[model samples]
Target: MAAYTGPGRDTLSDVLDWAVVRGGAPSVAVQVQDGDGTWFDAAGTADAATGEARAPGERLHLGGISQAYTAATVLSLEAEGRLSLDDTVERWLPGALAGNGYDGSRVTVRHLLSHTSGLFSTGMALEVQRRYGTRAAFREHRYDVWRREDVLRLAVSEPPAGAPGERFWYSTGGYAFAAAIVEAATGNSFESEVDRAVVRPLGLTHTFVRHRADPGYWGPHPRLHSKMFFRDGVRPEDVTPDNWPSLLEDPALPPLDTTKANTSWAWGAANVVAPLDELIVFMDALITGDLLPEAQHRAMWATESTKGAHWLAHTAYGLGVYELTLSDGRTLRGCTGASTGAHALVLGTPDGRRTLAAHVANDYSGFPVFDRLLEAEFGAPGFAYDR
Candidate 1:
């Protein structure tokens, strides 16, 4: 009920200053915009061995922010009359997703965009990798696939969960199904569609489709560590590296790069990678109507978010964007991404009315530093800050 009335929320001036004072080495690159204007800061190290503090203009892989980009592209296609939000997935991918497990005919594009399709998570799909025993099998089977539908044939197995338009369940598999529809309707790879529809329109230079095994594009990503020890109130590494760590301890992560396929990325689900700056620019533009027509813009942002007790502050998802209400009563529309050791997030107030901050770190976020730094900048209630 109380707003953050912190002493100096106006200037997270103490944020980086404290790090410098404590001799704490926090290498971070942030592009922020208060109501006034934009500012860029890169004070973190890109690589310890290289002593590369994040440079002023370097490209880092933006994880799930790609979802927003996906939405923009889909809406752009709608403008071109190439697709319809009301259309059903069955219309696009006939034999692939018709009246069997789901009322694919009734499941419109809107459902997927709003995350209301009640689709199950994509963890089942990842299980298919087990079929390929040798590492070389993973390379040939996982990486070489171009069509998402083909992967769906092998990977996707989520029978419809809720009704056609019932409750909400966060699932990238649904988005990937949407991507399959886009491809079926347009006859082009989802990568090509996004490149033309969103990236080119916004002039996002550093963004690209991570459709293939391009380590150069992925850049440097740390191994992922998680909260295996949930009850310890301690980091998971303390409970001894979890199963994943044990699996990937030796050569570390088993080089998922052997194959060109980023199946984990799925279709329109996650196969996007961009620099942090480009992500902010894209979000700012999308919110300000630099991307969509007025009506389409309203449709995308105004979609209903039927979230429950989990994330009470705010829980809304559009074609690819999520609107999160921070503790300060300002809604920050953004997304979070995690893959192995790579993690990222981009959050900011609409139109840069007050503030914007993005974090991209190579390790898992349960380390507690993330939420701490986030609160330090975007304070919680009773902080007596400018908000």
Candidate 2:
């Protein structure tokens, strides 16, 4: 629980300092666990206004990492024989994906979990883009609440990304639909289902879901910051692809404090929050087969190639997790979550012997540092930088 001065401690500190001093992050916190023990470290400020330092165990939005929890819940349901991975969307939520050229019967729970359902993301809808895509729109509508039905309707308003299982289209709408299916199959809220499946079983004291109406963190946490610049004279439409780089580098502007923004738009799919340490435990349990039955656990890590999916570099999509390949050609299982101003990642070896979890108070750009940090800790080259 003290400052890490073990192997690679200096290298980790250098990267952490770089992230805050030059990488534009307000703060960065990282925790790593292995056979020796657990180590935690932080750099930069937790609150920009207060100049408070970031610390380990500080709760932050889990972002896309919530998909792993949702995935676990659905798999547990399958383990109970209440549902099947191959169950069609229509089997549970009868006509939800029927419109927008989507055949609900053609999409299965597995497809949704693996981002292969081909459902167009509600977050990518033109209307959504016009309203919340840019910093200006975000500032203006940060507090707006979106209902579950509203998100579903927005999703089907667009055409399918591809036929089910044909392409890897990363869609939060897919997870939302999966959450809806979980509700129909269990007759319970997604949060309760996650609690039953992931939280309670793993004894995670700090992890919980963020409801649509809630726009704040539950306990002590760092202030989330984002680089979605919102200048006074500029409109959302004005920040185009060609000029965003220049705008991002303008040192005169401060990052936006998105800590208070409502995340209902991607609720259920990316709403879970927890401290970094608890996240490591949950991820390790999930990876080590402590949370699901043998067959289901195997299925959870049965990652397929994301050749055509909107995936990260050196990563492939699993049921609700990611299989990240390192430079050594070894792969690890993990998940990533991001809210407006925060980004989080949980990565571990397949056997769960070693794990690393990190949170950044800036946008996802802070992720590249993980590659170096991982190598420094685990003795393997990471994907972020070449040695």
Candidate 3:
């Protein structure tokens, strides 16, 4: 609902147009807040099939950015004395993480939230999927469902990369374990807890945790596409209608249409959706301490080394959030996320004076436009990156 006005609107529009022209992202939705004014804009198509143009306020998957909400929910429960960051995974899930050289007894909730758990990632399973899970394979088993245990089992089927808290290693499986902790401690489903702690409290009516039976998007949501298989002698695919069961099946195939995929595989890791406007609001609230208590908020930004774990430079991992030190001295606090065909980046100044939340209907590689857009809005000095 925010409107871009004034002289800068033209610059912003130009940057967005350039994104579609050069970044290869078919669609992009962005919202920015500066002091008291907010701006929202969208460029390119929402659905290739319908030739629908992207619209402001349309929802898109938050991808790994959903980790921020999960972290906030856990921290809220901690504030309620229902859980503690130091609590070990074994304390809640018992022997849930016992095999493949993984020891849950030594992995604390903080470790999981901070990506220091060193547990095997679902990416370990993905190596197999990429080889055999092609588009045709996905069509055959698209609707298959996976339970939480199934996800945990797949993650641990391979040996852990490191010991708990020894170093930073991004792992969606760790967050899935954290979600299980939320359930065990709160006596509520992960979806309900996130709703109670983050979504409802923030009045984010457009956001929801997705499930197998749930349609991926609500009204007017953008259809997601990807260039995942371009390197494999295949063209870009519209992965907006099929389930992601191929993630667990054999003869791994190319990235299938994940738009309607059952997100149970992602669960606590990356299954949240909201429009750019709502995400901007969420980032503003998060950085300004509206989401968690002072201690937890501080903890969320207390980052550790993520060297070699992330693609971006000057990046560090915090509790479910990423601390990115811009070329300027200012630090942007929020997270970046990617699903099959959706990529999101939400960041805000510590004082909440400026916020930027942008989503592109493409994969992780389709993010240069966002960087350029950030530089356009925040000045070139704030977003100097290696390309």
Candidate 4:
């Protein structure tokens, strides 16, 4: 890894340039806001075949960052007195988690939001990986549709990971349950709830929650490419038009087209899509207490230690966001998302004065690139770039 430094050079541009050089992805899009001002930049080709440069406002799959919206909606429902965070899942949808030795009564809305519900993630099931996890399988069934109930059932059918709240376990299935609770309590679709609670209120015109049945809903966006590993080695593959599901199982497959895959399988957990700029706005609002009442907002940041979670290092899992403690003793509150060929990250101070939101048109392996960018952006004095 090389560090970029020179007279009159921009830090954001240099960081993105270094990411590309380090093979973070074939293309990257980023937005940053500080006391100085705001900036947006893109690098590499979005469509490898056509050699099109990545655009600034191109929409990309939000991945697990969608959890933030889902969590916020749940909190909003709690604020309205429609539900309580401590309410059991069975209280909202009876018998939804009765089988597979699972007890919804033992799980609460808070547990689901915090990923402490002990639910086994259907997204991590072996069968799911074989059927829709690889690039080849993704191409075979890019348009496969799934219902919320069916997906939830598949998740619960798996064995429980542990007792509810025993320890921290990141589970997409928990968020699925949380979304179902939202629908049941509000008597409206989860998508509709998100629109009313977050999108319309924020004037976010480009953000949307995609459903599995909507196959023809390809709006204007950049071509998504995957930095997939093949027998030959890692290479960039244009996965636009649909194939995100491929990376769900085995992310090491050869980069294949995932831009057109049905994302319903990731519904409620990782199905939202938005441009990088809107993502920053959303994060700012979220961290600034604009989305929830004062107490609820405070509760949202009450984080649980993820020391042994084997997921994120030196981090804490909040209601739906993550609080990452940098090596420099500074902390950032935001979320990061990855789905197949798309990866995104947004982090800022509690006051919302400084923020950074970035997206890479690649898969899981791009995370290290994001780590380096964060170090460059917020590293403390005497920090060394050890790569």
Candidate 3 structure lDDT: 0.75
Name the runs in model 3 displaced over 4 angstroms: 6-8, 126-133, 230-258, 380-387
Candidate with top lDDT is 2
- RMSD of candidates 1 onward, in order: 7.7, 3.1, 5.5, 6.2
Q: What TM-score does candidate 2 get on C-alpha atoms?
A: 0.91
Off by over 4 Å in 2: 2-4, 229-252, 379-387
For residues 1-387, what per-residue lDDT tens digits would candidate 1 score against the true structure?
A: 122334345444345444334423234455565544556554445565566665444555554556677777778889889998888877887766544366667778878776777665543333443423224444455544445555555323646656767866556667777777777778988778889988898898878876644433545432222221122122223322123333322232323322123444455666776766677777777777788988678777874564551322355665677666666676666666654334566666666554454443433331233344457556632211111
Better of 1 and 4 by lDDT: 4
How far off is residue 12 in model 3, in Å?
2.4
In candidate 3 the C-alpha lDDT for residue 225 amounts to 64
Q: Kindly indicate the candidate among 3 and 4 with the higher lDDT.
A: 4
Q: Which ten residues in a row have the lowest lDDT in candidate 2?
A: 378-387
Cα lDDT for residue 47, model 3? 78
Model 4 C-alpha lDDT per residue in residues 83-109, reported as the tens digit of each score: 999999999989998887899899999
Clashes of each: 13, 4, 13, 10
Which has the better lDDT: candidate 1, or candidate 2?
2
Clashing pairs in 4: 239-257, 239-258, 241-259, 241-260, 242-258, 242-259, 242-260, 242-261, 243-258, 243-261
The superposed Cα distance between candidate 3 and the true structure at residue 381, in angstroms, equals: 7.2
| Candidate numbers, best TM-score first, in rank order | 2, 3, 4, 1
